[model samples]
Target: MALGAHRIPPGKAWQDPAVVFAPSVLRLMERVTEEPHPDYVGLLSGHGASRPGRVELSARGRIFVGERRYPKGSPSPEPETFMTTAELAQKFRANSEGILAHECVEAILEALQGLEKVGDIRGLMRLL
Candidate 1:
C-alpha cells in the first residue's frame, strides 16, 4: 500500500470495531501522527494476504496468535505480546543497524521509482 493511505475518519475512534490491536501495535499507533500504512492495518485486521503466522482478530476485539480459538462468549485468551522497547531496540541494532544507511537509500530509490511509474513528476521532484 502507498504510504499514509489509510485514514481514521475525523472524530472516529481509531480502533476498528471488528479487530483489536496487540498492545505493542497500539503503542506504535499512539506514537504516530498520521494514519498507519495499509499493510499494518491488513495485518492487524487479519486479512488473509497479510495475516502473520496464526494471528487472528475476532469481531469482538479478541486477539489470537498461534493458539486455539475459544468458543463464542467464552473468556478470551491473552493476546501475544511483542518485544519490549529495549528488546526491540537491541534486536534492531543487532539485525539492522549495519545496513541502515543502505536500506534508507534503497527505500528512497524505490519510492522515487514508484512516483515515476505513476507519472507523479511533482512528487518525484520534491524527493530529489
Candidate 2:
C-alpha cells in the first residue's frame, strides 16, 4: 500500500489485483533478491498466491523483504474497503455457522454493536 500510494500512478502495484502477481513485479523482486549482500538477506511471500496469506516485511543484516496476505476470491483495489458492516457480519456469521449457532452469532453481533455497555468480557467469552 505504501509503495502504491507513493507511486506516480497511485494504484499501480499494490491497488490493482492483477498486479499482485504481475511478471514485472516478480521480475523486480528477483532482481532485488539477486543483488549482492555481504551478510544476511530477506524475502517476500504471500501476495494473494494462497488463501490466508501473510502480509509482512522483515530483513536480516543486508537484506530486505515484503509480503502480503489476502483471502481467496476477495475483491481487490482496496479489498478491505469493499466490505460493509452488514457484509462483514454476514461473513462472520457464515464462518461461525458450524461452531456457533445462529442465535449465538446474533447475540454476538448485538453485543458488539453496544460493546461499551458490556460489563464483563467474560460474558462475551462464555458465548464463544
Candidate 3:
C-alpha cells in the first residue's frame, strides 16, 4: 500500500481520501528546497533522443517533469510522458525569471576550474 494512505478505524475520517501528493514527492520537495527560498529549478533526466520529454517550472515554481507517470528512475517515454523538452533545453527559470541552465552550468564549472578557486557556495552562486 502507498505510504500516507488514509487509514480508518473501521469508521473514521482517515479514509476521507489520499492526500493530493504522494509522500515521496513531498519529502523530496522538502529536501530539495531546504535552502530556504533557494533559487530552485528543474532539469530533464532523460535525453530527447530516447523519446521527447521535458522538465519545467510549474506556476508554483516547483520542478515538474513530464507527467507523474514519467517520474525519476521510471522507464522513459511511457507514451503518456510524450513531452517536448526542447523549449526547456536552453532555458531555466528562477522565481519566474528566465535564465539559461546550460550556460549557468558551464559558468559554474568554469569558475570551479579556476586555479585560485575555493570551494564555497557563495562562489558558486556567483556563476549563475
Candidate 4:
C-alpha cells in the first residue's frame, strides 16, 4: 500500500520493511515539526489513508517499551500489543513493519511529543 509517495512493502517481515517506509515516515515527522498539534493519530494514520491506524501506533509503542526494557537486539521478550505486525499488514493491506524499527519508533515518539525536530533525514537514514 502507498502512503503519500512511499510504498509499504507487503508480506515482508518486520525486520526488513523499514527501508521502504522510513523515508515517508521521516517526511511526515518533518512536517509534524512545523505543526502545533501533536497529531500522532494523524501521522500514523497516514493523514487518513485507512492503514497504519492507532493500532500501529500502539504496536510501535510496544516496541519502544520493549527496547527500553532490554538492550537493542538482545532477544527481549516480545512486547504485547492489540495486534501483531503481520496481522496488521494483512488487515490493512500494507506492511506495518516499517514503523516498528527502533529508530523509527523513537523518531515517531519524539515527533509525537514535539520533543525533537526530525529535519535531518540523512541522519535518520544513517541510523536505520
Candidate 5:
C-alpha cells in the first residue's frame, strides 16, 4: 500500500504522449525513475496503492527507478561510413538514447504534476 502520496486517478501522463510515445523505440529505454503513482489509493477502501514512478533526467542522463540501462554504441563492422566510425556509432547511439530518455523523464514529470494539481484518486477518476 502506498503511503504519503497522491491517489490520483488514471488518464493522461500529464505530458504530451506524442513527445514521449515512441512505441518503436520505447523498448529501448528504461522505466520510470521514481515510485510510480506515489499517491495511488484504491477507491473502495481508500487504501493508497503503490506510488507511480518518479522519473528524472539530468545532464548526466536518464534515470529509471527500477529498470535496466540500455547502453548505446556501434560495432566496428568494417567502419561502414565516413560518419559511422566506431566512436561515431557509439556517440550517435548515446545521443539517441539520451534524447529518448530525456523525453520520458519529461513526460513522467508532467504526469506527476497533473496528479499533484488534481488531488485524490477521486479527482483522477474525472480524467476517465
Candidate 6:
C-alpha cells in the first residue's frame, strides 16, 4: 500500500525507501485488511451497478478511492458541469511537477497549447 502512496494523497511517500519497506508499515497494512471497518462498503460506484469502473476501498478507518474509465454510452449525469480551464491547469501543474522540472513542464504545456502554429514536430520534442 505504501509503495503506491504516490498514486494518491501524501503523494511523495514512495520516494522514501526506508518508510515504504518498514516492517511496521507492512503490519499496519496487514491489520487493515484483516480488520477493516464495520461500515466499510469498499464499493466501486460509477457507470452503473453492473459496470462500475471506479473503486473505493476502506482499510481500518482510512478511505482510499480510485477511478479509471466509465462504461461506454454512460456519461456523467452532469457532463456539462466540469472543471474550468484554470482548475485544469492547476491540476496539470501539480501532477506534472512530480516528474518533470517546473520550467520544462511549463515549456511542454506552452508547446501543447501552440501546436497548430509549429512548423516542425522536432520543436515539440525539444521541449519534451
**Winner by TM-score:** 6
Candidate 5 lDDT tens digits, 22-67: 5532442443234434434433134222222333444347543432
lDDT of 6 at 109: 76
Model 4 segments more than 4 A misplaced: 1-94, 98-103, 108-116
* Model 4 C-alpha lDDT per residue in residues 16-116, reported as the tens digit of each score: 55754576666755543222234555653553322221212223346221112222223334344345544543543334345466556555444534426
User: What are the C-alpha RMSDs, in order, of all predicted structures?
Assistant: 18.4, 14.3, 17.5, 18.3, 21.8, 7.2
Model 6 lDDT on a 0 to 1 scale: 0.57
- lDDT of model 4, residue 25: 65
Clashing pairs in 3: none
Give Cα distance to truth, residue 51, candidate 6, Å.
6.8
The models' CA-based lDDT, in order, is 0.42, 0.56, 0.42, 0.41, 0.37, 0.57
TM-score of 6: 0.45
Error of 2 at 84 (Å): 1.9
* CA shift of 51, model 1, Å: 3.6
Q: How big is the positional error of residue 88 in model 1, measured in Å on the Cα after superposition?
A: 1.2
Which residue pairs clash within candidate 6? Answer: none
Report the lDDT of model 1 for residue 103: 55
lDDT of 1 by residue, 48-104 (tens): 223323333333577543432332223334233334545444444444334566555
* Model 3 Cα lDDT, one tens digit per residue, 1-128: 12222332222222334442656545645544212122122323334323223334444667554324243334565664443443232222222133446567656556655737666768677665
